[model samples]
Target chain A: MASPQTKRQKSSKDVPYELIYWPGLPGRGEHIRLALEEAGAEYSDTAFSGDSAVQTVLGYISDTNLGDALNPPVLAPPILKHGELIINQTPNILLYLGQRLGLVGDKADEDAVFKVNELTLSALDGLSNEPHDCHHPIATGSYYEDQMDEAKKKSSDYIKNRLPKFLGYFERVLKGEASKSEWLYGSQLTYADLVLFQCVDGVKHAFPKAVARMGKSGDYENVFKLYRAVQERPNIKAYLASERRQKYGMGIYRHYPELDEE
Target chain B: MASPQTKRQKSSKDVPYELIYWPGLPGRGEHIRLALEEAGAEYSDTAFSGDSAVQTVLGYISDTNLGDALNPPVLAPPILKHGELIINQTPNILLYLGQRLGLVGDKADEDAVFKVNELTLSALDGLSNEPHDCHHPIATGSYYEDQMDEAKKKSSDYIKNRLPKFLGYFERVLKGEASKSEWLYGSQLTYADLVLFQCVDGVKHAFPKAVARMGKSGDYENVFKLYRAVQERPNIKAYLASERRQKYGMGIYRHYPELDEE
Candidate 1:
């Protein structure tokens, strides 16, 4: 095994990681995109557009390079570069990037990093599952309209049960923070804060009613403040305003008021 | 703010943490159990039984100290303690515990640790989604019989695409190790190895035909061997034998021959 002295990312060559994701919905890719953008690193993004996405996803999943072997997810996008690395789970991907980016903060800061990351991932998981539910609602195989009744039920379960659980968890993290500053992490912006922004964006896109009704609760105010602050970061602001920050559609967040209970 | 001293395990006059999950079906609880067990720490599994589980699950989703005031999920075995912390999403839980157990190995080993753990999390995510598909086949809300065709499609996609993608990635990781060592982290064991054992075990129980067909891909030989070794470890062996290692049922894995496209 090589010694640690030489392995650290002390030079430019260390920034060779490539991020792959659908050119459409910003979705989970934002977490990764944000980390890379904020870090000002030289990672490449192999973004796919429209009809080409499916092949791109499949090709990456099936690649046999020891560096790129196995699949990350046969889904929208998976990120890779060097160190023989690939990851599909967005929060998992972000956690990997957070370590390299300053997004994770420091060792003394990791507990919040871990906790906020966990909550962010849980929210994203809920959102992703619901996204599929948006299309299929009943069976992943059948059309969403075909299973409208079942879709309504599943979507109801999601809007009523899942969203609050996630938002409430974020609220608690804020409440429990050593400082009362708004962000989920201590006071400053962390990667978790950005994901929370995405989560809010997704929820607002998918379940606006549920989110608005529940917005009366005190927990969301600070989370919203953090969300707005994250939105204002120069790099983050640019990404969100760019075409790369595409609106949610057939992806992880789809708008259908019928799916969102009052 | 408290000054940096040591990130000591949560030991207090009050209970350190409370882990709530169904008494049966290891689901996502196994990883939490592993963390607690490895730490040799004190904890109370809040709802490992029939009634408490339902109450705990409902309570967590609805309440503030538990849910973050967002919509809750129908199936979330959440953990609470140490400053009223509540988190779900299995990879997040395991990531939190890796450091706690000293199982994460080394800081110099961060890249490897992140890669392997991400792979492990990706594997578990695939298992969870596919396991859900085994019964649903097509979608989430409909009865098992309602969407068998869709279930088949989803499962087929999983077996052909996801299974190869995940397993192949790990196979490459083991192959890519500089010393030509078998472990994903080269010589050492990681939380990823343990989760891989769970994935293999779950696949065998839930989709025997698919795994059987995949039939011992060469790279995972070390993983399989490690699984056996983990089983041999006195604590793990005892845990498996104990009531704590809940068998697959309706939650994480369900053996449905129909979904297992042999």
Candidate 2:
């Protein structure tokens, strides 16, 4: 049952990888933060305090030699430094960290993690797109107010249909996992649970009634419990206590109570 | 001066990796195609010819043994199988393929690949979202006809502004290459080149005028020329010549001349 490249560090494995993300708003950074905290991997959030590193990362993205697959690569956060590997993409980063941290469970556990990760990601994507839609309800190039009328309509559909459906799916998954009752997967606190918790947290912030009727999520009690569980982890507690974690803002989870209407 | 783990075929060289993607419509499959082509490794594209395999794959996504990481992760095509590892997500799949295919360049190259991948993907994201917009127009949740008025406005901006901006960036990168005039990185053809070609092809199908205005793309003439060159490659040519390449009806690119707006 040997997998490829399953080697351990022969050198000093003391230091964790450095994560370079924008210093503000947990927006996307929180996903990585949750995984790292859960892994308790020795890592530092470089530029989590100042704007200098954030600018540098963005700049490097446009400049090839400086290190950008493409400027802004358009999305840069949760950069994973595994020994030497620097991986990006929240799911990709989480998957890597999960495998190494043992947060990724057995075969079935891994599958659940991947499914939930993808599913939650779809919800997140839908949510982010909705935000953008609100701004450019009429067109992506125009100002929000110009498209305010259209935004009202798109935002209305999102509130009424998409939000509840996405949240409800999670509620169901969590409920289905009721037998396990504590984690998204089997027993342990895997990255999938962390990500799902983040999604629910983000959505709850963005849509209260939608998520509320989405139920107490009492059916998937363990999943909700795991959400709280992530916060309790020592490294997470420290990271949360630190200034690194960004609060949700207009970026990802804007508090638009009107959009969450039943 | 060698990078650690630079050696190949170190493990799990037994099972050849299988890439299951649509037969046609470059769409996201191009990302996977480029990664493998760059690696110069031999692989198979399953369900490439028959419709049944693709249907099975779609079904596979819902009922995955890998659970969440299962089939066609997130309604996109192009799935990769490496021994026990099955991955989806264009960027995630490409990253994994690049790692195995030996297409990932040096540290700086790796960083550039990631940034470019992210940026390019966001652009593609814009394209997909906009494509949906063409249908939805005024509101994302409403019927296409319902928002036809808004769809026209949104479509106009996407055509005139977004297309050029995105395509122009590619033009800049192609023209910005330091060495080769035929590829995106080093002296060799990287996955980026392949993706650009497919994107160009997709855009041409979706919006001919904007791409034509993109004109010669002399900036990254290599990237531009490489598009034609890669299309003529033995495998690609052969693939296109066959049935696995898919017809133009479904997926990312569609012929809505009205949306393109001459």
Candidate 3:
């Protein structure tokens, strides 16, 4: 394991990356944050800044908030601004950062890049988005309490069917020869590992009982091992303990006792 | 507008792209199909290839049925197999094809590729995924009729909020200086435009009345215009007219007349 000091030294310059997202909840921004931390990249987040930072985040999405002519308008936050480029979409941001931070793989291996992206997208589809939907099964705009009945049904279906399916898929991937035992792809840790770790963490928070049941079932041994491996990485371990690691709240992976089953 | 003959001439090989997706309905697969068709790339779809093809598709994801050691396992279809690389996820497949088919932009313009990818991801997030939830609000495994009450509520929220929010965002993007009065990015047609076209078409089919109202309101003129422009493209027009184009039937964008409002 690389020391935190050595990891920080590998990062170029000081605070080149600017992440504009809503403060408080770990949300989707945590996926990007984990990657940055794992790479020991020097970046600043608006979540730590004051209330006005929220406006700055909203400004990019607003039709009226025109700043740089070259910078394209984004639809939502978890927007990454580096130099003149401003872009959104969590997976897209990760792709860019993975390449820039040399976290993906060798630049020459385009096939490996696409494979890592495939893993990232699948994780987001199953773990992040589907889990979010379990609570807000009807509409994201509406309160989860308002759709409690529907959420209960969704959560049950998720725990029984979807959760195992996603976890099992990753477990298989980790067991594959490509994983090489330590990472999701190849020999080194890629951004996809960080993403999968965050996703698993989010699921654990959202459906503790379901995850615990799965853990006891012993179906996803590789998946749990991969999760532990990501957690124990020196830089990631430091970041997780630090105040910089925001606690999970009313974001993509919200914990509701009713939404979980033992 | 390039003739179908001219467009077909540009393709590298004879149907090297194999799209593995569910048969019958045009779901997320339509997004990938639109790109292949518009580019006049020769591609064969497993949907029409018979029952055994379904097994072949499932073989990639099934742990016991692993055929290729090199090909990474995929969770779901809309999986593309070209040469040795087999990959899934619509946006990821499109990103790969966009670069290979010269549908994105100049190879040197790395920034444009990311920007186009951003647009593609945003469309899938709002138009594709959200619209699918309108019918299966509670559980995706269950039928829409089983959750009719919840579907009605979800559909109403989608019509009132999500539909316009997404269409309007694209409208703004189309009106941006980079669009140049023709496409979503720059003066050329990218896969993002094809995706936007397919999404609008799906919305129109699913929520005719709501789309009619938005069309009559005269807000998303640019969106409507881009939709029309893509439909008029020579190769795409031919593809739309051909028997190869599958109709929307109980898929992502289902037409439940009760869900639409005038």
Candidate 4:
């Protein structure tokens, strides 16, 4: 059996990870990028591949495409390619990376890793997924302009109800005994913290006024603290300041003045 | 390391799994229950405990609850308590059970387990989560009656566009080389098949007209074939016939005639 150190070394050295996602905005791909960047893992993304990047992603998800004997067909991008294997789904990608990058925990402590994953899924659901639905409440294929009124109503309810519920849950999680440190899981930092960091950052971008009010009101002190802690991490800090980190635009989190808190 | 058979034996016999979820409707709890029943694992649920069951679930999820030193507080129900550990999130619970119940794959086949999880997450997102959103597009806290118009719009969009996209993806997956058998992964059945079965069944209950139309159109032959295979599994067949299986009502999948495909 490979030692954790040996496993980490092999994963980082042997495979040159390829991240396949749309180029412009971060979208769901940013979560994968954050984990890669935080670990300082050797990787490449289609962010700079120009027109071919879009085609490459589309090719994998094309209706007629039946994945080869090993890999399965992809539904959407943010796919990770390591050696001959290819996989997608944001949380799934994280779960795969969490072990390889030494971001989860010791292999012996399986519970900790699963706990981290559970926290990540919850964070993604309430913060990332629900926030995305606010603008596209009627249909993903429809334009935000067409669903403007619905977006307004949904965003309002999100700020009033869902936002507090999720943020409060995380705040409580951070205060739990297992979280002796600022990280969501154990004393050691895990991929879940990176996910929550991105989630909080995205929601702040989407609903600045509402998030700011909650922050000022001291409702989520621990949650904001963890966000700030992740932001200040050396690799993540450098990544955020680099040209590689894509800005939020028409992706999951969008800031329309009408959708912001009143 | 223990053999797969030994590990399965230990998990099933040593830890009497206690499933904690609201009684009556299947809801998200059904997904977890289906997995347990399929494995024929020794488990108990709050279904027969009546009023106390509600209190027990609420106690774990109460806002003031700072879970004991080992476990973190639960965000919501459908929690599983095995030994000293208490975990929530439907997929997380399944991931945990998948390992112990030997439903994912062989321990050495790590990729298969992760792949099963990826398929489960995708199935849950498109089939399970989106269908629920069709009725409560604006806010989960709001009543279906209040959001009836938006519900109609979201449900229509779900039926027309999203449903086909997801079902088609699964059909293509079933045809992929990796899925030599009826299952989503390798030749063996994994927890993903169980999840997909539940998702398809829930959607059928939610939108009978649309699902029936697609069934007759023969769009998802492989997908439905696998669903039928899962339903025919002896344990599942028996569980369905027993009173242990809750009826679907005002849960994740609801039958609102107006929300049906015209």
Candidate 5:
């Protein structure tokens, strides 16, 4: 079996895409990083730089320093700057990169692009955002420790209900005719598959027991297979082993023993 | 100023787009509805029909009945079925409709489409999903009354932080070169502007006192002006007056009075 990395065409542009995200934890930036790594695209992530670089990420979001001209000042980091275009929002940045990097399908099939986008957005909604809320149920401004009691309840509901639903949905998508073997979309690797891989990886870190149980239950067979397939890809495998891959911490998918279920 | 609706090119497809959502309230569906109405496109909403129609909407979501063949089973309502494509996410549906109905910019400028999509997704994140969470702080499965104490805390943080951050972001977007006048992107009307209008409308219903204060503070002048401009559009104005327009209730944006700040 040939690695999917061998098939990806290098980005025609020589411009190295600049990704500005918080240092340390993977957070939402992992999704974009996965795509760039898988495609062997030229990019420089600011997260690896020192604390001063993190300040550069914060500068874009701060109201006082937003300068006089920039429209739609970003509220958070994981901001992508490619030449003149500066954009935030993980899924939006992915959509733009998916198109530019040819991570989306053939240019002529416009509908397929939308379908891939739909899948990516849905995965983000359930896997990333909801999981983040599990640790901070009451407020984003407050710490997880401040809302641990509420987090426990929210995590219970999520582990029982949403986790299965989302995982099952992706499993079915894999089983569909559109995804012949391992890809989430029609017959080829798209950015959405990378997103799903990161989401599952994060969920596993967050709720080891629950995810382990789901794995043993033999329910989402295709989903697990898809995760392994992405993991085995040459570029991705190398990236995972390298120091560039950030570890899971107090980010979106935190491992709080109290929040997990058997 | 002439209403932007007059310039909208109707969807070429003869098929009346079917919108499936919860019966009573205009939640995420309103974003899609606003686009269809502004373009004068043909659409049939399942919410207006009988109980049997609601059952049909429920069937797509029910796991046991989703059948074996369907991939990526939708977890919730507000599903759009047009021809063969069945997509759920609010921003995804709007993206599809925006392209088909010519609500997005020139089809040739692909980057513009993504930019418009970025804006729409950001608005949904800040306005729709966040507001919904305010009333359901602990869990979506639970009711507002069950989480009243938590809801109060969440709503206070939202009013003080997230609401202004989002509204101010849009106001800045409007003040930019991209939006010379009424629209959020470019000089013409796009689906994103309609989405912004609905979001502002929803936040107002969910937190009247806070929104009123924001209005009086003259902070989000461009945002309020964009809302009014969308409201005054001939087709949108008529739709707002018509029976077809669903009122806000216990949906994404709800008025509990207790959740509002003076």
Candidate 6:
């Protein structure tokens, strides 16, 4: 989509959006990339720059880097730079992009916009944030090995309680009246579905045996159904097969055999 | 403040806003309550409903409670009910209330709105959510005593690293050009300032010694300055003194002598 507002532009270009995040690993940036990719919107990914982009991402978050008059300092990536606006925070970026890319409903439909944002926030919290905590229960800066015992406890508790709580919640959302279609929101697919898809995919990757057991139990039928539906979307399918969709590694969602169900 | 939109109204009201959250403690719900109180808008707080309100909050999130077609199922508390809308997620509720209550900015100023929301999210992340995780590092459902060792390590790391990082970040924002006024956003007080104030207050309550040392060291000059400013605001001052402003207890921000600085 062409840049709509003049005030937002520092300069015009073939692509207006630039995503500055850590190199490799889907991490949180995957949520932003999914929204952009599903919309077929061309944008720059700093991850494509390889090693050099690591410092670029760090610079934005560095204590010394005081953001300009308009934008405040970025705490962490994925930071989206569209012209003069340097916005961070995963859900905030998705909210901004959702409005522009039509991932949310029309501009006038404030209900859909906020509702999509609400669901997006919930998925990011319950699925993305909680899963990350399982591997790094004690501290973010510390190594996973240092907190292995706590990680095991966290991972087990997550599988038994938090995981099912979130999955079942989404399952309920899908079966609810608002989701008249196969999607989580109204008839159309929004960024929320894409987010739910990525988080579920990461969870399954992290704990394959447990997720498979839950799948077989027929508890989250619609949640898995939505996940598969998002995967098969024309744009998303192509993007997932492409190099643009990064792999899961030692990132937010990591696989540890001991932490998983045997 | 009157309810502005006709579509939002289920019926006319003396108090248009109803806050449904866990009773007794000033948890996440305090963020929404601060905005309503600052705006001098009338709101119905379920906390005042005594022991009975706990079940009402639980009812909203109950597995069997399938929300109406317009509103989806509420996964957690701090749910805001305004006429036909029942919005959850602290930041999302703040976003909704900010616009209506004029705690953000003028309706046309989308820039301020999103910027404010972005900052609010960051504060909620670094300050509120992270601290909650400190005590419950392993699992939210688990007792603090069960994870006391992990909590100590997390709290120590938080005090040494995360606390300074967040405090310093906000301090820079206050020193930045955008904050010509004392508030985090533009000159006037926004919901962000209220959020920052509440989070900082909670942090202080949780870690008195660490925060006192940081204060005496002359770091976070502007952050604490803004915090004091918010506290002194007429409406805020009244709210803080009143019984409506709940105490910090075993909620998100807790005080444990063992968790504090030695």
Best by DockQ: 6
> Would you give me the overall lDDT of model 2?
0.58
Clashes of 2: 34
Question: All candidates' lDDT scores?
Answer: 0.63, 0.58, 0.85, 0.89, 0.82, 0.87
Superposed Cα RMSD, model 5: 6.8
Against the true structure, candidate 1 reaches a TM-score of 0.75
* Separate DockQ for every predicted complex: 0.25, 0.17, 0.33, 0.62, 0.32, 0.63
Stretches of candidate 2 off by over 4 Å are A1-24, A40-124, A127-142, A168-181, A185-187, A217-223, A241-243, B1-58, B61-87, B95-123, B126-143, B168-181, B185-187, B190-192, B217-222
Task: Please list the residue runs of candidate 6 whose C-alpha ends up more than 4 Å from where it truly belongs after superposition.
Answer: A1-15, A106-108, B1-15, B106-108
Pick by TM-score: 3 or 5, better one: 3
Instruction: Give lDDT tens digits, candidate 3, residues A1-262.
Output: 6556435534422448998988998999999999999988988899999878788787778876433444457888899987667788999999889988888864554577788898999999999999999999878888888999999998999998888888988887777766764777777889999999999999999998889888888899878888999999999999999999998888999999988995
The residue-level lDDT of candidate 2 at B21 comes to: 72
Sort all candidates by DockQ, best to worst: 6, 4, 3, 5, 1, 2
Writing each residue's lDDT as its tens digit, candidate 4 over B1-262 gives: 9667446545654768999999889988998999999999988999668889889888888888877665678899889988767889998999999988999865665577678888899999999999999999998998999999999999999999999999999999999997878888888888999999999999999999999999989989999999999989999999989999999988899999999978
Candidate 6 structure quality by residue, lDDT tens digits, A18-59: 999898899999999999999998799999997799989988
TM-score of each: 0.75, 0.72, 0.92, 0.95, 0.91, 0.95
Q: For residues B2-55, could you state the per-residue lDDT of candidate 2 as single tens digits? A: 223222223444677787776545556766765565455777776455667667
Q: What docking tier does model 1 reach?
A: acceptable
Candidate achieving higher lDDT, 4 or 5: 4
| Highest lDDT against the true fold, candidate | 4
Compare candidates 1 and 2 on TM-score and give the better one: 1
lDDT of 1 at B234: 74
lDDT of 1 at B117: 63
Model 3: per-residue Cα lDDT at residue A75: 89
